[model samples]
Target: MTAMGKVRGYNAGAMLLHWAIALAIILQIAGGFAMMHTQIIPDALRFTTFQWHKTIGLLVLALTLARIAWRLLNPPPAHAPMSRVESGLAHLVHFLFYLLMLAVPLAGWLVVSVSPTAIPTLLAMSPDLPWPHLPLPAAWKGEGVSDLAGTMHAVLAYSTLGLLVLHVAGAIKHSAIDREPSFSRMMPLGRLPRQSTAFLAVPLAAGLAVAFFGGGLAAGRLGPESTSLAVNAAPGESAPAATGASAWTIDKTASSIRYEVAFSGNPIGGTLGRWDAAIAFDPAKPTEGSAKVTVDAASIDVEDAFVKSNVPGPDGFDVAAHPTVTLSVDRFEAAANGFVGHGTMNVKDKIVPLYLPFIFTESDGRAHVTASVVLDRLVLGLGLQNDSTAQWLGKDVTVKLDLFATRAGAASPQS
Candidate 1:
């Protein structure tokens, strides 16, 4: 090693990494606490907060790995003079910080992976980062264990605060009591002696960083194929592979039916996995349009294990007896917002009036459609027998449809 006096400050790369990780950790701690065990923020807003928390936690994990790699190749400045006992304690605190930086996020990731709710962790809550859940087997997922894992994540995260206090106190002690350059050594702008180290020129550092990230993904793949996050279908039932004899052909590949409801004030979104639409409509003559949609009653997947288990029972859709739900529209009327389909929805045995508002656009032979329908689940007796008071599950649910279709003779989008 070079003489201790020769290197008086951390490399620029080390300083940048330190500050970045510190900021991310601080954000995660504050956001994580606000989302858990508190009524500080409204439950509705917590949904967005939960996503922000996850996104920052992942960032901390990434930066921590990078910091570890940087520390390995670039030597840090020497410690301030102190007794052997004091030096050991400082080193131990640092070691624990690094360990928790890795463990806390990993624990959080595990909590999401095994959670019973079907919520996804969209990086930045945007569609861009398409982060996938850690693949784990069915045996590792459920309500009981998910709650326990959540508790562990919270506990591990709170421990970071204790370590932060000790770490800061040590820096202050070195600067104030010992009158040393402990804090200045890591500052970006200071009169401290700067060390010249090949920060990124080292191939070993890059290799270790890659290993750290790739190793985690590889471990997830080793487990059995992850259970479907949101999926529901009855035996022998499946989504149509191609357009049928309807006036328009639905491109199942280019379409989706998603539903959202507020559960305990937090939004729970899901999908109807097995459904098909038959359209006999002409955009040129809006008033002469007609359509019908059939949805497998058992395909109500909200991603809640308890909800899924009971959703097809006597108190819910009663799939064995009802088998399917249908929406039929006899005519469409021109509306300011595009068009409206005055329809009726049949759930089990009840027939309730419904109005679907949607916008439609056609180019060449393909037609694009997007519609939103808000229905009161209570009126239709969905989960009414079990949750009559609208206690856990909210009363109204919004179903969104986005699909692309082609005139019957035109080329199929799926084809």
Candidate 2:
């Protein structure tokens, strides 16, 4: 090799992109591992971490592409003198690193795309990245595709971990042990000391250890059996009678149904503003009483206009296609607290059995009722069907109802 072949330092743009991508990769590695332990982290925080990880992965992919183009347009600084074997090994590692840089995130993207959950990838909690909703082949549908992609992603991540260690060790050895300017070639802000490069390995090693072991621990703790809720009823059950005893009328202004879910590590709740209920009940004749409710799915107001508008979108309530959600309860039995009702709720043309526990009280010829129920949103086709999305958004949703009613011939409470 000629004396002039020795590289002095990397260009400004190259250095910046290198360090930025490195930092992002480290964060992504750590976050990805931590996110797997949803049982350990708070729900809202876990979901937020996932969004951030996804966003960073995409950014890394873009940066890697740009770096590749830049390298082609402007070749990297020449290497310091080395034996032919050393040179060949270095080039091989570099090539492998680049391949992994591209493949890891691409695998992750595929995992998300083929996911049955159909969860949207949002950037910074606002603008959503456009992801293709491609149909999987019959052989690759259901859990098969997601599992394969996920395995690929995990394997690629560990490969990156190994590559990262070798790359860092090589850089440190070249600069510190060999007393060469090899590491300096990629630094824009002049050459760092050999000791500093050696020290860098400490944190890198610590990070890799955390990511590998933490991910393994999380995976073990949160196995397939640990994450899923017990599904008691199948979808699409027949509707039951609403009332069996005395007929009653719901006071629209005095009744409301609300729902709560976790988003970004916070509890976000909203009311179904447009709904109607029919009640027929008598404390003396509990078996003869029944109740029914109809809700305008589009009328969900989460307080945030943006979220409210999207709640009825294709991935959400799909209000345009299925405008109404209905619930019917034909069986009512006395309970320790108050009363229990076995019912069925139909949303988006999908029906699931519902169990309602409620408290009822009457005074001044008017009855006041407060009831609550928990339902699996996926079973009712209210959201995406993938396991990851279910973990992020929570599978079970709690619905609470408050109502005041009067018998057909009874005087109104206000009157």
Best by the TM-score measure: 2
* CA-lDDT, candidates in order: 0.75, 0.67
lDDT of 2 by residue, 295-347 (tens): 77666656432234346666667776777778888878889999988888878
Query: lDDT (0-100) at residue 230 of candidate 2?
Result: 20
lDDT value, candidate 2, whole model: 0.67
Off by over 4 Å in 2: 1-6, 33-44, 125-141, 191-254, 261-274, 281-289, 296-325, 330-368, 374-396, 404-415
User: TM-score for all predictions?
Assistant: 0.62, 0.65
lDDT of each residue in 1-415, candidate 1, tens digit only? 2233543888888888789888888888887877776789786676677777887888788778778878877766676677798889999988999999999988888887787654445567653333456767778876777788888888888898999999899889888777766777888877767877874734565565566556644443342222232333555333333343437888888899998987757778888778888887776686777888889887867754335545666667888788888888888888898889988999989999989989998887888999998999989988775566776678889999998889887887568
lDDT of candidate 2 at residue 134, scale 0 to 100? 30
> Total backbone clashes of model 1?
0
